[model samples]
Target: MTQLTDTHLYREIHEQPAVLRRLLDKEEATAAALADLIHGRAIDHVVIAARGTSDNAGRYAQYVLGAMNGLSVGLAAPSLFSIYHRPPRFGNALVLGISQSGQSPDIVGVLAEARRQGALTAVLTNRPASPLADQGDVVIDLQAGEERAVAATKTYTAELAAIALISAALSDSAEQRQALAAMPDAVAATLSMNDAIAAAAPRYRYMSRCVVAGRGYNYATAFETALKLKEMTYTIVEPYSSADFLHGPLAMIETGFPVMIIAPAGVMAAEMAEFAHAVRGRQAEVIAISDAAEVLATARVPLRLPAPVPEWLSPITAIVPGQLLAMHLAHARDYDIDAPRGIHKVTETV
Candidate 1:
């Protein structure tokens, strides 16, 4: 059966890039504005609002900003903050809202409330001309170009780029900036593996069922990869952490089950490798994917990233693999690669 190429999901994934040219170029503006906003405002606290992958991006930024600069950065669900939770004190606060499309009603509401209470606002989105952008004091577009797929790809990476820049700007550290420059090259290296993934797709697509496992930061990568597989290949995919997989999720494992472990060779290597051993003992096929080479000879799918930088920086590098897997699997299954089932480029929920 030949794969159809007209679906929105197809085009989006096919064209998905590690370094979206325009979005990459726009980082300076976003960073400059963010820095100016915080540098001048005598900032009191920081709040980030996002949903889906953007939420993960927000969480990454929150962790980076707070740890790197001692800034009080926190993550909040847009709907919960506006509809249920009280707004944080705003006079000295900065509100950072992230969404691929700047039109979600919940996001719009949260940003509006933050502004109404005196918080300075910034919106990071692909659509700069969106309604939510209308509400922002500054609009930092991802410049990911037209993403036709319902599941985000370039936009997500672009969001990270935008946030990475913003985080770097808020702190007075050159190390952060140096790390950012190295990231794009690492992303490029990851992209080079796409062809390798394409060659491996037939093996993945025929598998009866598969499990993707990870720990700490890579857990998000694991879950997102599972979602891509489910959305693209209609595969019976489950994502579990290394620790939790042994408890309950592992019981379902037997001879035929294939396990893909995302152990990115940083903080969680020891524990992840141990989980791999347990999975192997169960007589299940284990495929260990890592930034370092620690898995047993027969189980290794080593992803050689640009040396395990900081843990915070590791997630950005790992995203490249998830995108590759999703695209290739979808292509192998002959499913629509661009517009997936029941996905909107921009989700506007109240």
Candidate 2:
């Protein structure tokens, strides 16, 4: 039985598929215009600046831009300009500032300076009229209206859609767009598993800490899911790429410690399956989000994807179940689903 208690986060999560479709239908022209600017200026490098949830979106942007356009992508350290007052050369770069509220002082500071340094600056924000949007040479609205929840469900997916749209436009690949067209349907199917995920919540009700792992394009999913768990459930969660996990963090797993793995069917699936088997060998609880039968079989608790989604577009769909797990786990533990401690809708840091 699905929990009947209604929360802002729960409502927003259900609203994502509609919001994503609207973005695809409406943002086609805007995405093309941004692509034109990229080509016209001959951007050689890409730099993205964001904070909190938006930074996770920026991480997805890094992977998409690198894989699709073959451009060098780097995440900006806002403190370099906001705190130290040092400006690096970005004359031939495309700098993107991502903020859901478009009100973050430091993110705007980085974009303002990037523009001053002769870089082509763009912003992906829900607010088109905000100061951060004003800093953009071009502004791509997320089209996620008035997100009432503090934890950010619709807005985060909106950011991923916007970034994926930009990447597809830059490449001018109809095949990529065709692949992306499957996302809304995939997301819808994922939402149908909410009841199942909620039922599985008790398995992690006592979970105090965990590791979220992924690789390649879904690496950002790992980071974002861990962020959601920490923010809403107050769990001490660490996120890592599968390779990074092997380096040192693998030692942290004790007997029966919860380990959440996002291993969608992709080139990285086999590698992730191997890691999952190894974790199970350590007696840690393996909670896997995957569509691969082999990976699913290796897990103690399986939260399956609806279909075999393409690797390039997996992050947008794969993260939905993770978000549901975090929300359900928090609710199961009696935490406030709408408001977590010491956090606000818009975080302003300088």
Q: What is the C-alpha RMSD of each candidate to the true structure, in Å?
A: 3.3, 1.5
lDDT of 2 by residue, 1-350 (tens): 34435778898999899989988888878988999999998888899999988899988888889988988889999998888988677769999999999998999999999878878999999999999999999898888889977898899999999999999999999999998877888888889889999999988888888999999999999999999999999999999998999898889878998889999998889999999998888888898999987789888899889867778889989899989998998888888878888899989888
Off by over 4 Å in 2: 1-5
lDDT for model 2, please: 0.89
Off by over 4 Å in 1: 1-21, 39-45, 71-73, 81-92, 206-209, 241-248, 296-311
After TM-score superposition, what is the CA distance of residue 126 in candidate 1 from its true location, in Å?
0.7
lDDT score, residue 40, model 1?
Answer: 95
Writing each residue's lDDT as its tens digit, candidate 1 over 172-221 gives 45888787777666666666776676776677777657899877766767
Which residue pairs does candidate 2 place in steric collision? none
Clash list (residue pairs), candidate 1? 8-338, 8-339, 9-337, 9-338, 9-339, 10-337, 10-338
TM-score of 1: 0.84
* Best model per lDDT: 2
How do the predictions measure up, each by TM-score? 0.84, 0.98
Which candidate wins on TM-score?
2
